[model samples]
Target: MMLQDIDAVIFDLDGSLVDSMWIWEQIDIEYLGRFGIALPDNLQYEIEGKSFSETAHFFKERFQISDPLQKIKDDWNEMAWNKYSYEVPLKNGADSFLAYCKANDIKLGIATSNSRELVMNVAAVHGLEHYFDCIMTGCDVEKGKPAPDIYLAVADALKVDPSRCLVFEDIIPGILAGKAAGMKVCAVEDAYSEAIRAEKKELADYYIKDYTDFSSLY
Candidate 1:
């Protein structure tokens, strides 16, 4: 009832449900360091919500790095696999919120920019594989966040109307994507995106500091 007749809840993985946004920052620093290139101060903002493949391309073009896109992706995937499996922890109240959805018979799905292998591996490691009815990646769609494609795909897979889905996201692009898909978007607070929190809040239909802030809705 609090969710106002929402039939499904879709989540963005990295910052919304999992405390794993640091991995990308670490990867950016280390990856560019190998080439003796310093990571730019605005680099994080530049690629904040891009898909893995789009990020690889950005690195290659912006940094003038010689590595191929596939190579960069492979390297990042290998580097992140360990952290995702063993170190990344779920966000506070994330488990509880997921349980709430299940108990209330709300279909759940994941619309993520992460690679499929890493996503599945992390899910398996955390024993979260069964929590979602559908898990879709940016790669599964033609375009990533800010395009509405990924979110739309998840809605399609879940057989839910876009208007009946509630999306939780931690970044601006994701919030925009959800809105573009005709769903209500809630911006989940994440430290990595703190600087742009106001923008996110302005763009999203609602904002939550975490899953605990259920005063508005889940």
Candidate 2:
């Protein structure tokens, strides 16, 4: 909806604010290949909303990897660094929408399942570090999306009531997390989640193909 109705706007980083979802699947394939394990077709769906740490744990247990969890995370971060630094781009019109939010004095924050290092790298790449009031990762909370912990933690960090916050997300679990936190949720369209568009529309209060769509709302 309109900016006037919300005091804060929280965003999910990966598919929501940037076109980087493709990188993860590539990483998963490459990483698992290193262990001589074939990538499961359902792997992405299985780990949809899990935190970085949780995903590492899943990989460790599910694949029976011998490496410690931290090593797994570190290796992933290393593999993803160059790609995120070079290839990932912000979603269409995201910069302008961030600018609009800044101009309107609306607080902004990121509640992402991604690691803090990666999310920060994304901000640096797009010169978006200054746009956020808070940048929280799922590791900061006990649970990830669909449980509402990360979004709630972010709202608390921003000192805003959950009801006064609006969330932009691109996946079903993220939309569910925002709604569970009592915030209005806007489902963002991303090719990675295109197959589940109808479920997203049904679950979210609003849906947009890109940040540019916000222009029509006002």
Candidate 3:
């Protein structure tokens, strides 16, 4: 992918910018267990690109959960906090890629479906807060991935045209979202999304196994 005309690089946090996708599945299993509900096989697929609040609502409605929305979200945050802080790490070579963008005067931003609190905490833990000019959660906008809202909002916040922004995304909805925003989308590889790898490549403008693939470009 050429960076010649790109003014900003936007990332989807969970599987694209960091190795935290596994953490969510674990949280789902444990969270649902609390209500004595066994996780459905297609639960992840059903909630693939939903925002944090949307997911909480899904659980409430689908599982007939009695807890208020905020409580469900709070429980998830509490369960995932320690894992995100200590166990999760940046994607391979992501730090170098971020520094490369910074050195080239390219703006950086995060457009994620995660909650703002969790996203901010992850950024703090990874020392990534300084690298991003904007950090937008899906709930900040009216819609989440598969819609252009979050990515468009991030570009707008950065004062960059969507056409000049390049987006790195891991899942199908996110890749579609970036493209829908008119940004060049790069499909990133992640273990969690391996099942649909071919579709991701077909949908995105570029495909990369990891940030290390950019080494040849620089």
Candidate 4:
């Protein structure tokens, strides 16, 4: 299917444009270790598209952290940010895809569930800031992914119609949010297992195994 009508493309940061989900896995292990809980071998599918507050609630409730959830998230952010500062790399074919969007005059923006500080820093550290017309984070909205708020806000800020923009997402909640906002939604495979893949396949309009598959998308 041709994404010929797409005038803009919005990207989800962690798993879609950059392979940073694995970083979260490492952090989860360490965080749980500090609390003497055995970390699950997998955390991505549960955590994707959730905000700090929401994630904190999940960890707290699931593992009984006992502290205020916000504090837990803050501590995690402090720990994660240190590594996020230097380790961001564009996923395979992402830079080329960005270039393709630019060359064709398609508007670009980042609509991520990540914090603004982390998102901005990663974009700059990897020289991706210049390609985007706007950058928006989940903090900017009252509702994060699974709610249309962030994607809706990014489309608004870009001054584009929602129908004219497409979204690249790695999780079902994000895909649902984008589609609910009346945009075409595409999924980028980011190391999900078969079970995860079957679960996420239903939410996205299209699925791509790699960025190379997105080359002719527009």
Candidate 3 global TM-score: 0.98
Q: lDDT by residue for model 1 over 1-218, one digit each (tens)?
A: 43887999999999998999988888888988999988799887788668878888888999898878899999999989899988999888787788878988999999999988888987898788888999998878888888999999999999999999999999888999999999999999999999888898899989888877762344
* TM-score result, candidate 4: 0.86
**Alpha-carbon TM-score of each model against the true structure:** 0.93, 0.97, 0.98, 0.86
Question: Between candidates 1 and 2, which one is better according to lDDT?
Answer: 2
Candidate lDDT scores, in order, read: 0.88, 0.93, 0.93, 0.83
Error of 3 at 77 (Å): 0.4
Model 4 worst lDDT run, 10 consecutive residues: 192-201
Q: Which stretches of candidate 1 lie over 4 Å from their true place?
A: 214-218
Per-residue lDDT, model 2, residue 92, is 93
Ranking by TM-score: 3, 2, 1, 4
lDDT of 2 by residue, 1-218 (tens): 34657999999999999999999989999999998989999999999899999999999999999999999999999999998899999999899899989998999999999999999999998899999999999999999888899999999999999999999999999999999999999999999999999999999998989988876633
lDDT of 4 by residue, 1-218 (tens): 43588888999988888878778877888889998988775566677678766777888888988889668867877888867777757788888889888988989999988777778878878888889999988877888789999899999999999999999988888888999999998888877434577666777878878688876654
Model 1 error, position 182 (Å):
0.5
Candidate 3 per-residue C-alpha lDDT over 69-133 given as tens digits, one digit per residue, 9 for 90 to 100: 99999999899889988999999999999999999899999999998888999999988889999
Best by TM-score: 3
Instruction: Give the CA lDDT, 0 to 100, for residue 129 in model 4.
Output: 80
What is the Å distance of residue 88 in model 3 from its true position? Answer: 0.6
